[model samples]
Target: MTILPDFRYIRPANVDEAVAALAGKPGAAIIAGATDLLPNLRRGLGEPSVLIDVSAVPALALVEETADGLRIGAGVKLAELALHPVVQRDFPVIVEGALAVAGPTHRAAATVGGNLCQDTRCHFYNQSEWWRSGNEYCLKYEGDRCHVAPKTARCFATYRGDLAPALMVLGAEAEVAGPKGRRKLPLAELFQDDGAAHLKLAADEVLVAVTVPNSAKGLVGSYAKIRIRDAIDFPLVGVAAALKRDGDKIGQIRVAITGSNPCPLPISTDGLEGQPWNEATARSLADRLNKTAKFQTTTTVGMRYRRRVLLASARRLVDDLWEKAV
Candidate 1:
């Protein structure tokens, strides 16, 4: 491992203090668990003058259950999230995603906020700087072209955050603290489609918490992830779904697909609502899965293979939901 570049470190006493520190310093970066940021800094991907530690901030580290939903603190570690009983019970898809993110050692140190707001990644972009330069740079890095979509002006890098799809399906909202004040937005709105700019979060803002609504509503939830290794690897394609069943009928369904864009794609098309929970609806979903999935050959897998597997992932989730309802 390479040594991190020289930078001043600042730890605040609270969220307000942290915000002040960030606002006062324009080039400062927030650090929670430092599992991902440290490595990126060492590799020169981020060169902030000050590293503002937000772990000391009380509100940023809290996990509470409100009347509306479960609130997960941004600074809560992934290991803690995986071990939380409520997370496992109410949001099994989230636990499923968090449990497999990296190994136990890495998860022990990686924060939930870091994972949700994690950096966008690509096979070529994550490599060593020297390696990237040799390839003449891709759209995500020093290069002018997107290797995956040469003709397209946008970066085709993949968003590998395991929990995003699940959270999207769960209808999560994020509370962000900034110099202006704190505000909440739907978690899905926080992400931009461009791989080069994964988050809409500002440099001076820190994601404080995520609110997950509670409603089983005869719904069966499932998440499917495909990675090279069992853990510590990013998903090539991930599909998370929540299907509400009314007797044998499908009352409502929300499907989110990740690993295609800089952020997960939440398929909000109608017709899935109040449909028969029969084989026909399941088959129809499989067909629509292919049409909405916009994938490129940006990772280890081939573009065609990735596209096909997305369908498989979607079908499997839908099938699992259907079987559970039965």
Candidate 2:
């Protein structure tokens, strides 16, 4: 059996304490549920000497409604977020996205922060140390070259977060706390194109909470994904779309996708607003998305197949939202 390496553990009571624990240690890793980190640790992906546990930080687990929209603590469990009545009522897209994450048991222990900031995964990088030792390691691990694309100078691991695209579609903001201070940024900004350094968060920064905008609330939306099985399978491609209707036309619209590339990609819906919702328009947007997204050989699914599914999913989501317009 693969065993986790030895590490110093520190549990902080609040965000400030958490930030302090990670202030000086570049090798320190933040753990909430350990659902994602523990597996990677056992696989010898990361060798952190220190672990800062923020699971019990009270402020990070609270989910409350605010004047803006909703404030979801980063430490909140995925199951809790999925089952929350307010989330189900006001943001069904988020509810669906959360529910689609993993099996109920895994989601019970997985935190929103962990999910949003989870490590990128590649077929070669996720193997056991012994398995990977047989060949050169990928750029995400100990080696200098990426196995997925050795000719390229960067890693091509896929970001597999389900909630990120959903939250991005709804115009969510991430509240990050670091040693210097706290800052709120668009959730989409948290992701960088590089797979090795996927998250934009600094080593000492803690993702405190995610706030959805008030305008996105009550907007008709849909979240869909392509996966091999019904449970416990990571999505091949995931799409989230939301829109506000004004009379018979769309007043505002947003579409975001994940599991398509190294980072979650948001399609430009600038000209979509004020356009009458229809299958033709949706198809056009899907075609544009297919041409715009960047895909690599990260997952088992081929890039062409993944692109087709993503475009089709986007088209279906748009059509569904239009039919169910409120």
RMSD of each: 1.9, 1.2
Query: Which residue runs of candidate 2 sit more than 4 Å off their true CA positions?
Result: none
Residues 46-111 of candidate 1: C-alpha lDDT, one tens digit per residue? 668899898887777777998768999998888898889888777787888787677888888888
Go through the candidates in order and give the clash count of each: 1, 0
Q: Any idea what lDDT model 2 has?
A: 0.89
Tens-place lDDT digits, model 2, residues 29-112: 999999899999988888899999999899999999999779999999999999999899889999989989979999999999
Model 2 clashing residue pairs (backbone): none
Return the top candidate by TM-score. 2
Candidate 1: residue 270 Cα off by (Å): 1.2
Q: Which 10 residues in a row give candidate 2 its minimum summed lDDT?
A: 279-288
Q: After superposition, how far is residue 286 of candidate 2 from its true place, in Å?
A: 1.7
